[model samples]
Target: MARPPRFDTDQLLDAAVRLAAEGGPAAVTMAAVAQAVGAPSGSVYHRFSGRTTLLAEVWLRTVERFQEGYFAALTDASPPSGGAGGPGPDPARAAARAAARHVVVWSRAHRDEATLLLYGAQDFGRAEWSEEHIRRADSGNARVFASIGGLAADLGAADERGRDRVVLALIDLPLSLVRRHLRAGEPLPPHAEDLAEECTAALLR
Candidate 1:
């Protein structure tokens, strides 16, 4: 039987995430990641082809993790029962609130990964990414757009402006709330999720 190596891909990626979160993309060099994880620099290179690939992996991993839950939240059409026997909460609106609240809740839960999201793929060296990496990033983006577009239609706002509003309520607004606090190196407040849900409900109405 073959023995496992000391540093695995996810371990290195985790170190890269912390480095990127603390000092931005420029800080996530192979040497820095290796040093952060107390692994040989060769171990970092063993998993990723170069700094560009490392950056790409870290960015994609963080984004994909965030989006997995976000996509689900946006697509949830089931509404909560209102009181004991009243009609349930509006399914579309409930989904919108859930999706919006998910942003803050996720950020609060994954602060380091959330910080990675504040910067665009371009900031993470996307221009140098492989075609495969580009496709992965594009695919995630297309899914998000489709989910939001679908939700907008369900909420009776299928027009372009209405879709834009959905985008704002679901993506831009909640992210803005997270960005402000993360950039300041402050923790998200206790009411962040409630505030996100409330603001989203107001916009979707």
Candidate 2:
């Protein structure tokens, strides 16, 4: 039987994530991650080719995790077609509400990961990433837009301006709230959840 490795991959990623949360992406060096996990630097290199790869993995992992829940919220919010073959309640508003509230719920639950996202891949020098990494990033972005676009279409945001508003309420509003609370190192305001729901409902209506 093969001996298990002493250090776990997720342990290393968690260290890197916390480092980014505390000091931003510039803080997430391979050496730093190794030290944070009390492992040899070679262990990190064994899994990641270089800083770019590490950062890409970090960003992609965070994005993928976030999208899982977000996609579900969007789906739950969506109103089934007037004929899934019978009339049903319109779900556009409910879907928008779920997506909006989900942002706050998710950020609070994953505060450290949330920081890494808000810090953004740009801070990790994503522009200099290898083509493969860029493709990965683009694919993730496309899925996010597609989910939001589906909701926008359901809500009848047929014009560019209308779509933009959907983007603003669903994406910008919730993220802005997360950013503020994350930067302050404070919990989300009690009203933030209700406020997010109300705001998205207003925008989509």
Tens digits of lDDT, candidate 1, 1-205: 9999999999999999999899999999999999998999999999999999999999999999999999988887765232122224688887888888889989999999999889999999999999999999999999988988888888888578988898899999999999999999999999888787778778877
TM-score of each: 0.94, 0.90
Best by lDDT: 1
Question: Residue 31, candidate 1: how far off, in angstroms?
Answer: 0.4
Least accurate 10 contiguous residues by lDDT in model 2: 79-88
Residue 59 Cα positional deviation in candidate 2, in Å, after optimal superposition: 1.1
Best by TM-score: 1
Candidate 1 regions off by >4 Å? 80-88
Looking at candidate 1, the ten consecutive residues that score lowest on lDDT are 79-88
lDDT of each candidate versus the true structure: 0.88, 0.83
TM-score of 1: 0.94
CA shift of 116, model 2, Å: 1.2
